[model samples]
Target: MAAAAAAAASPATAPCFPSTHCTRPALISLRFSRRVKVAASTDNPSPAFNSVTAFAPATVANLGPGFDFLGCAVADASLSLGDTVTATLDPSLPPGTVAIASITSPSRPSLATRLSRDPLRNCAGVGAIAALRALGVRSHAVSIHLTKGLPLGSGLGSSAASAAAAAKAVDALFGSRLPRDELVLAGLESEKAVSGFHADNIAPAILGGFVLIRSYDPFHLIPLSSPPALRLHFVLVTPDFEAPTSKMRAALPKQVAVQQHVRNSSQAAALVAAVLQGDAGVIGSAMSSDCIVEPTRAPLIPGMAAVKAAALEAGALGCTISGAGPTAVAVIEGEEKGDEVGRRMVEAFASVGKLKATYTVAQLDRVGARVIATSNLE
Candidate 1:
């Protein structure tokens, strides 16, 4: 059943027009060219809930040397912090079909309206459909509504949060039959649709805390332990502009020198060791040793160099671009250090970079995605 659903929702059959680039804005309309169609199996007749709501945290991907492989969820779930998705089963529509009613953001109405409304085009909508189809609970139709906390194209795993929340909510509404890994895969469908088929951001957004994509062939995810003694904090600074994931990925080099590959591997190993040992200083220092993608992408974000230097000077152990460009992340020792680093980074962006930016402090979220509420309407 899951295989059939995955095949139907596959991106290979999804539409893609010839274009110069695959930026986020450019890909929004492209999704309308295809639709996910599945047959409702008669064996399963489970009663679905009238409504379900779930929340997922924002994640930071490509933590330093662990490009396309590492990420962690932030614990904050404030209105402007992460995403919440609510799904309601619609009695009027046919089974095996889903629709998205609205996409809303507390701060950015224009951006919210600009987001795609089609289920095939929206991450949350696709995630909900995939989860329902995977569970074989096809007797009910549904509408998904997204409440955005993370800014679009802000390099904060905004799409992953929506996908994770929607998947979790849909699963809960149908009795939560799917296991955690299956839910992760459901959310991954959205990532594959919008971004590439990478699991760094999706895994952490669903499983919580720090996740390492150990292998791809078998799709293994290893969740790292976050020891209390580590005293870790994150300072995130998002600029005013957007850095589409497609463009950021396109900037990566097709190949690298043999020695550079060896160095990156060594740095990744050291950083993993530091994380395990709960050494904040070592972890911070190791995070700054990326030699491959960061150098090439750093120029796209104005004042990247100055902001990183300022963060380090203000007691940050290491600072680097979050996932792509435009948003910068700093690893600090504690809350005080994070505050100082955020202030300094903002100042650098204003004085040196001449760009206004917003900053926030967050801890590593251990709970990935969870159902916040459920209702059964008569």
Candidate 2:
């Protein structure tokens, strides 16, 4: 049933266009889970509470060399670039059921219409259901309403943000009983249902900071903290072109030589170390050193090399594709540098790629998903 539902819901399974590049497998098989000894709290639940709203920040995944394992949540001061989910209990519905009431994007109204409302197909619905199952709650039904703040296929962890917000909102509506890891697990399941089975995006969206998925089986996550003195700023310039996650995954090389693997592994380690040390320069250098995935995927995005070069020339510490493609992220230390780097990147996209682009300056979002509001029935 799950396989059928996933196949039916996944756009990657649809027939590819003659102009599209489709080579690798449509689906990824890396599943994630954590074995936690602590059980969810069920005592003294808020019986009167019936609704909750949660927001989860957008994430930059891969971070250069740490493909499929590293990610970090990012947001501007107002926290405007993320997804919101509202979970409301409906007693009239059947028990243990989850449904999507609506999906809307205030910024781009038409984008919402393309999304699915079916609980089995929608990320928010699947995430809510997974949370309920994790909490052992079977007596209540949930109706989810999703508000998308991030653009789809922009390499900003859009799906994961929605899934994280939904899981966090549903958990809060029931009494906020689930542990952080369990919340991540719920989001992971939702991401698996829609995108692929990877925790890099979901984990950081739920737990915040820089998360490294140490293991997939018996999933383990390591959060790296930034040094207090360092203030890291990211200049994210996204072109109008859409690079589907599935297609980007397909573009990746199936295998790499031993030397390249070792080089990438070393750079990944350096990235983690730089993050811990709060060295923006080293972090940027390490991020741009991704030889395998980046090289294979760069050609797929028009003007990518020029954009990266422009960023570097404009005083960016380093620059690379944010996740999949089209959204080039440049690292800088100061806010002023962020603006300059963003301008250069956008110009490169317009001149070289001939694609209009927009840029935003953001910082690391330390807090992941959180409940923004709650309602109690009188």
Candidate 3:
């Protein structure tokens, strides 16, 4: 809840887009069987519930060297921060119509209003549509209401949270039969509104814990189990500003050097291994080693280096830009050290960077997105 201002990206060679650098083993697509017919039943042709509300946790994409391929959920007892989506089915409305009834943020109303009402331009709307499409429910209309908790464009996976919550909420209202990965794809449909098909944020927000996006063509995801004893503590410093995903991505070079590529590949492997083994020291060192994207994006964030150095000096294992820019994450050994690292991060931003910043201390969220509430309106 403390306010302190802070800010890093990738080391791909040939100036390649960070996503393209994450090699895929294959580029196959999943094919579904022909649609099936459902027999009418007076027992209950409609879903059991009229409304379903879901909560999706915020995520940190990239996590240093894992650019566009790695991310983890950020959750804490006091920081139940994310986006919530409530979906209500209206049988009387025309088929194939998804309406965004309202979007509101009790804490930040202006931001809520800023989001477009169009389903294609809005994450929650797109999520609902994708879910319905997956369920073959074109005959029914669903009204979506979004309650925003995470700030938009703060590099905390704001769009992904909203999209994941909407996808989960809609699926729950429909019956919750969709496979987990199917639901994730539905969420990914919404993420396209942000620019590309990157799932570093979307996958982790939907699956929880730490997620590695192995491929996007067939859309494969692998969730890694971290050591319980390691207990990853995160200090997130976000400035009162906006760094659109498109702008940040545009800042990347079209390619990178071969030498940079080799170094980046090695560091990425090390970071992944560190996470799996619960080696805090190794994880921190590898995370701070992003040579490509972070360097290009550093000038966009004032005092980025100073804030990162401050966090390290305050006992943080490593610090880097959360995703895009402006929001910085500091990995610490234990929850007890969160306050010190966070304070130093913010102080550095304000004094050295001259930017006001706010931060929160949280642990990696293992639960992902889920239906928090449901109701029947008879």
Candidate 4:
């Protein structure tokens, strides 16, 4: 197995956050696609065991123009608590067996307090169970734990991280039979329960790096062929407020101007090209070029303009509302710039009122999901 390095190369190109510019090709195009190339593939195998631990990264959904079709994994996401699944040694029971057990993140207790219960329903856990069920490993008892790092419903793909981690852990417990796409689908299904029927957050979280959800029929997902030499930094500012996903969706305008739509499409495509070619300048330009969602959502969040301005002034490539709103993200060059930009974003949020802002500095995660440990009761 390859030793874990500090970090892998850029997932695809030097693209600034997920931006949706163009309508995906009507037909799936696997040939000459730039989204399939990745610098790393962690596929070391292990025997089915009794317990496991998994970490899932936070993800940005509807990146700029990609709008549910595109997204990228951000490192340092929340850690879904943990789970232990193993076959119970009971001669009295039937030959085939299946059972599930869940544990809460020590940080918080009581399902009522949790935004989403049925931990198995969580994106990370759902992906894990879906993988196990697909493998046909029906005879086993499993236990799960969760670690909540990112705030749920903050548009940070918080639930996706939990689901991805749990899904990967379940795969390990069952001897890792499911393919990558299957796991991604599992997470997507879990996402449907809370955030309505559609969201691209789980796809990138499952596969890692950048993903373009080109289709749902047989799921035509492609990992972007990002430039390895590129390094994009970010400042994610999460404000202290819970903006229900349902309400946020209702705030969107159903109609848009024709010219605004055209500009958005053109700029979104430009963002993709910039990422593919590793041009920060072009990507940065695209970050502020949004004609579809941000304008309408901006008013819902306080201090949007000021916070974004601070991020830019602090050397950010571009800035925008992260995931939904309230949480804003700024794209930058590297760690130094990320730190500086993050500081500015926090300060920017203060002008609104007495609000707490969580400033996160992150990079594009290149690798998808994997199991750190696992166990199966057989």
Candidate 5:
């Protein structure tokens, strides 16, 4: 204790730490001895980390009224990716400069070697890696592995979640020299590659909460304040089916009816207001408030009306499409009703043949996406 106290009081006698390098903006620390430690504090500066790993959550984008502009986070859906730092010569790297060490799903088996492809594609691993390449960050090479827990293209922002997670992992692995906003931009770049257009789903996955992407001269995002009285809960139903995003986008009419457009826009504003006011009833009511595409696209998914009816009867606040469709999302006032809503949804599916569909009750996950681990420090 006396020796430690003396070392702490005496900077000259304390074990000398790295004070030469400041290439990366991120600060890191490593403990070398019982009485000596290496750190970059307010009085110390050192080289940043060289590697990292990221974990991002699946997102529900364009939730009903907020098409192409709004999104929310989910807890159950998640993805992870790992990488190698290229700025310095390090080990644990494969030959292709950057390589995918393993993949949890065989969804996109061939993408492991396609460096030019966007990492945000249907298979999350590929999309994340691709997004990194687009950032012109070849100075760092990454070996990644992605876990696909969310339903792909089932109206859940699976690609966005994967891309954001991968982007975060890459940044952290490299000592997080990139700014928070820039890291989000990099995630969006990956999403664009797979979705073929830019949206805010991936950005807020890193930032958290409900985000509104205002595509103005100076692009900005507006996050709505969430209320505590309104308990967050959801009933997600995935039918024994799939709908490709490409097809669904093509189905949307480029030009909407003038009245319908106005109504949808109004509902979007109302929904945002409802959240701030802590009005669960209004929030659920607003879920059914979509007049733009739901009416036009409802028939695409079989047993839609019956499922919705069952969800409502089971005490759900509102019932609507999860993201695109096939998967229905139902809102509950509180978690107590969660099981009931789920059962009702399942019953509804049973009426049409239980073997044809499945549903689960979930909550509105406000935590957003984030990483769970790291590899090394520069």
Candidate 6:
């Protein structure tokens, strides 16, 4: 069952905080009934397992004009395009400690080697620690093993995926008592340590579907509904280039003209409305209408304009850069259309940008982070 319960709250519209601030918004209060069913009481404090494995899907943040306020989880058909984390109780380690056992990526071995093993420096470890603190469990230490399925700096929420998976795995190892909001908060803390204090990527990765982060100071999130008729497919073409989140963020304009802000705000609202109305065409159109951030960052990415144009020309509903991308994402209606649009975008990258590229076709992942396996102590 999905973690969040249906609740009503007005959407918040505060701009993102300055880069120096360490504090972030909190997720609105909502209990996870599914977790509550299995929560262990103080009298029966024994853990449900000694080890657990969890998966969190890759995510596309910003969604064009939404900036740091909107994101959605996405996965390929096999659901093999995200991060997996395994957390195990280690009695030998010091109590209340979280450590990284290994970081390996079967798909991107070189990228895996680049990640740090220090728990405080790594998202997975930090996230596990955050979850443990939230659970008030310091009886045993945790050893984390992270398998990266997505490349870092791909604008695919790589760090957020690891953090979400680790947070879920550690929480489940103790009995899955943490509410969905707390899990998201853990992911946010991890992101703040590694990326920035933004929940756009982590929230969707933890809760699934499209999430609208209404406010950062008060930490309000509204999980947008996906209409049944919205059969949207995303074609993601990632070029052989690095566009780090820090660098992409630095490329943003410090201030936007009032007219441009109004235009982009309307587009963001239209995109949200399109999702609620199940209008795929409008969703695509609204997603491609971002004028401020996109315009500022597009020039930094070679062939981005051509790639977007090519995707549209190849019958994509709309095309834009995913996250702080070198990855160009296009929205389409069907698998076949995704294939064609992906091919054209990749070709544009190679021909116009002089860079090799790869593409993945994915659907929205409604279920967020989840445990795939567990082993109990004898």
lDDT, candidates in the order shown: 0.76, 0.78, 0.75, 0.59, 0.55, 0.78
Q: Compared with the true structure, what per-residue lDDT tens digits does model 3 show for residues 1-378?
A: 011000000000001111211121112111111111212212222464789999999899998778899999988774467889998886554554566777888888787667755444467766776666666564556778889888877888888898899889878887886788888988876675364678888888888988999997787899987888988888999876666676778899889999999899899899889889999899888989999888887778887899899999999989999988679999987799999899888998898778899889988888889888999867
In candidate 6, stretches whose alpha carbon ends up further than 4 angstroms from where it belongs are: 1-45
lDDT (C-alpha) at residue 311 in model 5 = 84
Q: Encode model 4's per-residue lDDT on 60-81: one tens digit a residue.
A: 7766665556677787434331
lDDT at position 351, candidate 3: 88
In candidate 2, stretches whose alpha carbon ends up further than 4 angstroms from where it belongs are 1-48
Number of the top TM-score candidate: 1
Model 5 regions more than 4 Å off: 1-51, 76-97, 105-139, 353-355
Give the lowest summed-lDDT range of ten residues in model 3: 5-14
Task: Output the worst ten-in-a-row residue range by lDDT, candidate 1.
Answer: 1-10
Least lDDT summed over 10 consecutive residues: which range in candidate 6?
A: 5-14
Per residue, candidate 6 scores C-alpha lDDT tens digits across 1-378 of 011111111112111111221123323231111111111223323478989999999999999999999999998877688999999887766555566788889987886667766554557765776777667664566788899898877888887898899999989998998888888987886786445678999999999889999997787899998886678889989999977667778899999999999999999999999888888898899999999999988888999999999989999988888888878889997677888888889999999999999999998888888899999887
TM-score of 1: 0.90
List where candidate 1 sits over 4 angstroms from the true fold: 1-36, 39-45, 77-79
Can you write out model 1's per-residue Cα lDDT over 1-378, one digit (the tens) per residue?
A: 001111134432232211211244324433553335544544454656789989998888888888988888876436356789998887655566677767788777765776666666567766777777777765677778889888777878888888899889988888888887788888887777556778888899989888888886797888887786766778999877667777778889999999999998888888887877888887788788899988888877888889999998998889888877578999887787777789899998888778999899987788888888888866
Candidate 2 vs candidate 5: which has greater TM-score? 2
Instruction: RMSD for all candidates, in order, please.
Output: 4.2, 6.2, 9.3, 11.4, 13.6, 8.4
Model 3, total clashes: 16
At residue 50, what lDDT does model 1 achieve? 86
Candidates in descending TM-score order: 1, 2, 6, 3, 4, 5
What does candidate 4 score on TM?
0.77
Model 5, span 74-131: residue lDDT tens: 5643222211112221344421123434445344444333321211122233333433
